[model samples]
Target chain A: MAETYPKETSNTVNRYKHQDPSIPVPVVLPMIGQIGHYPSDQQPHCYLHGYVSSRLMNLAASPPGIPLCVAATKLDGFVLTLTPNTHNYNYRSAILHGHGTVVDDESEKLWAMQLVTNSVVPARYEHTRVPPDNAEMASTRILKFRIESASGKVREGGPEDERKDRRREDVLAEVWTGVIPMYERLEEPVGGPYNRVGEVPGHVRRFVDGENARRWTYAVEAARKAAPIKRVKREDEG
Target chain B: MAETYPKETSNTVNRYKHQDPSIPVPVVLPMIGQIGHYPSDQQPHCYLHGYVSSRLMNLAASPPGIPLCVAATKLDGFVLTLTPNTHNYNYRSAILHGHGTVVDDESEKLWAMQLVTNSVVPARYEHTRVPPDNAEMASTRILKFRIESASGKVREGGPEDERKDRRREDVLAEVWTGVIPMYERLEEPVGGPYNRVGEVPGHVRRFVDGENARRWTYAVEAARKAAPIKRVKREDEG
Candidate 1:
């Protein structure tokens, strides 16, 4: 889901570009039944979802399914202002509202499992063992979520201090204020004990390098107030 | 809050240790009024909070106050299994239930602002401009949340596949299964345009290097099933 905020608003303020999804965002899966009861006057139902094994799924499965929510966030930069009052962060976050249910269909469960595996490292499913055996399939449980609503929020750009602070010559002269760009960097992969492979596989290496560069470039450019360069020309473009 | 999951249950499983708060988790402040209304049948009082300007706070202030929730999560590693069916992730997450209100007291607001700034990078508050001026204070809005409830959930360690898969000699021989350690690395800090400082400050430099080393060591040791080396002996030790 994409959201737009007024230019003046503190949240949903995009700097480099509006509603860019290529930037990797952190994902969150809220826990179900973890938070105790909210007052009756407050919102009653909160949802959370996570993967489960068949053993655990059978134990928790009841008439009505479990509640679940999935969320992800991408931190852009740390906005450092001259004063603490104006400090802020640029970020993009999304939340998915859903309820968790067991994936009963064998093929669908396998597909979901593969999807999740590949999500950690692109195309990793093809590199590993193929279809799981019957016992493995029977023991594994996939929590298929039926999503109800989803929302995305974003905040970007340099610090937004008050006009008076910005005008203060003395403070501005002494105190340096700007964003310290921050992004996750994937380091050189360490091989496992039984990793028979001579070197890190091409796919794994490429994914690590590619993702690190993409995020680093985006954050540095955003801090410098540079817009992302479009690779393809659109028909509507003048 | 700490949750104990039944050995047979799945969602709240804690693998390595229980409720270790030193790990840096991603902090999230839910935005108010951004998420559309939840159906009363679901959860009635769903509260969220986001940072706002002092100007907006005055306009939005009302009795009974706004509800809010703060969340943080730390991703430990990606659990890679021989088969796709058993893939999982190691993580730690915390949530705080609270009500948001404006911090009207000047000193308290400054203190809270400093606390938050330093939280991003330890000792960072002292490095920047000191107490905010009146106009900066007037414009900045510190959301003093009255926390009512809090809870933490965690998952860690290697993949836990079906017993049959673990026992299968042929599967074990051919298929490699282990965790791909993952942790957030702070990249080289970028200086601001007007940053007159000759180099990255010692404290900031040390923090970046220290955090990277700490996380890297933890992930590597966990991947190898090695216990962390204790820097100091506990009081209980002879």
Candidate 2:
């Protein structure tokens, strides 16, 4: 895990070392990432996956950052309505601003890209094709925004809910209110037909291994909760 | 739908009219999203997420006279390696650049946030509850990035394939190569558990009704193929 930018020079090695190494840094970091939504218009505001992880060049490559420090979510939902202005989507997002940096060089590039990949399947880099060449290596531009500060916001229910909200009468409205969750799951891997291999790698196994296997060490527990619920209760016939 | 920013005024309309409408606007955008890495670590890189988006925006999102654009992604994993550096993960992303506008008003704010939301979930905005109180709308920051150039990049397959790759290269390293394809699917809505009355709202239903059920949407299709095949009958089966 080599540090990419801002290398330590002979002159600056102990420039700040002698001083308080823990002086607060500025909120100079920039925000990046995507805002995802549900495929269905009805359940628009589903889940937003964004985060700001800790970035102290001194703490990278070894383990990288764990359990992302700051995260944000923007949920959205459509309001099929009688008017265009009335036609809207509900949403909420939590933006956690902080610090993080990009993996530097070819090796770290490979490591980080693989990290993102294995987030879906463990040991995935070990189970897949090696990056073709320097060109392949150069193709990916990974960046990290070290943590600084953060936040979260959301919207739920439906247009009727808001309209009833608008009325705000003593009577309770019949409009339904609830939240629809969105999830990203692993699909069964499709091994190439020509590849003459049967044994799945431990890394691949981490993602696709059959049930009753090792649990995902990373990823949010929401996914674990999303796993299949076998209702096959072995109940007493009595 | 309001079309007018809450602060829209006649003077502002005349000012905007002086500017060329098609000449492009300023917004966040990106060009080449290079994920740099360092293999053999002396020091480690942070894997910049925030500033990368910022820098990408630096390239895409405008500053003064430039147009708007964007290059956004969802960080899906952290590829773990056999040795520590070899780790990698599967991911999906889109890179775009062009005219953009930093959304700064109620109307654009409303739509921009919606656009970002629906970026992940199609038609979601129309299906959920939206805030009617103008006050809540006062603080939303939405940016409009009109894309001029764009492309897509994705990584799939497991480390097993790479292992086989290593064998062909006379590389004794039994590196695993396979996919841990990123997965995101809709979860059932936990409605009013009490179920006092009423059915699902029309807006939410649009989303749950399967905006992505067609199996041909960009978001879902990108993921579906990443899994291992179960059975191979005949190609003509389709």
Candidate 3:
């Protein structure tokens, strides 16, 4: 399937952080992000939620939202090879480029709140205290970024080594080439200080169990898949 | 202990992407990265590896190099609360602002290659084919980013709810407040197509077992800790 979004297990977003408008200072904020389409929109826009600094809020509140880019990534496995230069990772990454604006419509904001809450755990919105009071609603801030352009890439399968390394019997015998599967594993729920509920609810339990199984399977499967066409190795710096 | 760098398990880097020189297009590339201090440097800088587009390489090749931001984050858990607004995540995030340049010194490049290789799995470089041949070395590219300014944040502990929701007996009684501990889990290694080694090497096995244990412990511990001071809920939208 051509997946346009990261798996359900991923709900995090990273946006470029600019310290000052005059100086192009590159920084990124790791925040909660969900993709949703409001009633009035034809296409889905990204909704960002988290501790947004006041400067970013001000930038977004102006005419057009701050120029924003959203990136999400999930590491599947470590692809080990006969040589250090050939080592790679099985991963999925997506980036969205757009201008972000603060959402002012109350109903649209309310809808986004519900959409994001349930995105983590199904039916979580209805299960929680309904209709946030005026003060609660007033304090919340969500940035809506209508994606202008987007792209993604997925890297998978076992290691592919150079002809020199592959031909060397000594190297092949000494080096253990393979993939170390990696995934996000969710463990048992630990109740908080004031939790009164007797047992974990059905929604939470189901989310935990379902996600664990899916993430594990994906990582292992990616590790065993066929290798992609070889290209020049790109080192962070050489 | 205060960690200036991300844990050993994390070797990935995310840099802001700009498509056009004139138009600021926000983009991010997920690539392999490591931190190392060359013998000549006063302090450590970030060493980046992996497939870097020609445009980015050209930008970095310039006199000052490209303005770069590197971000790293690890999700510890999902903090569930009595109300949707109070939901949170236990995470560790770091951002570094710097200028990236192409490494011209072959000796420094070779040292970095070893520094990054061993970072993922201790002593992995020695285990692999020694001294990448001239062809192999020539094809590889790594980016050296001198650190200018950096910052990081860590959020742990279980959820904290509002007084209004905490006071409502019905809400407290129904809601299951807790944290679903999450971590990057490394599974059994699967040997590749051309592997001749009979057993998984000592280094790979130790890495998988050691990381799985450390990551799981950290996540569960974070989930049970005390929550931070109450703050206004930052919604994706209000």
Residue B123's lDDT in candidate 3: 87
Model 1 chain A worst lDDT window (10 residues): A1-10
TM-score of each: 0.63, 0.43, 0.86
Best candidate according to lDDT: 3
Candidate 3: tens digits of C-alpha lDDT, residues B42-121: 88889988766666777778877777777788889988888778888888877665678888899998999998899888
After best superposition, candidate 1 residue A62: deviation in angstroms?
11
lDDT of 1 by residue, B1-238 (tens): 1111111111232221232333211223344221122232232222222456343355327643443345566666666665665555556665444345565677756666666666567787787677766776776665654444444566655556556666766666655555667677666665554445556667677877898899887765556552211121111100
lDDT of 3 by residue, A1-238 (tens): 0011111111222222323333344446777789998878988889988766666777678875676767788899999999888888888877666678888899998999998888888888998888888988889988888776566677888999888779999888899999999999999999999989989999999999999999999999888775643222211210
State the TM-score, rounded to 2 decimals, of chain A in model 3.
0.85
Whose lDDT is higher: candidate 2's or candidate 3's? 3
Q: What are the clash counts of all predictions, listed in order?
A: 19, 174, 17
Expressed as tens digits, the lDDT of each residue in B96-153 for candidate 2 is 3333334345654555445544543455454334533465465343334333233455
Off by over 4 Å in 2: A1-174, A199-203, A209-238, B1-69, B74-92, B96-142, B146-151, B154-177, B192-197, B212-238
lDDT of model 3, residue B125: 95
Error of 1 at B13 (Å): 36
What is the Å distance of residue B143 in model 2 from its true position?
3.7
Give me the candidate number with maximum DockQ.
Answer: 3
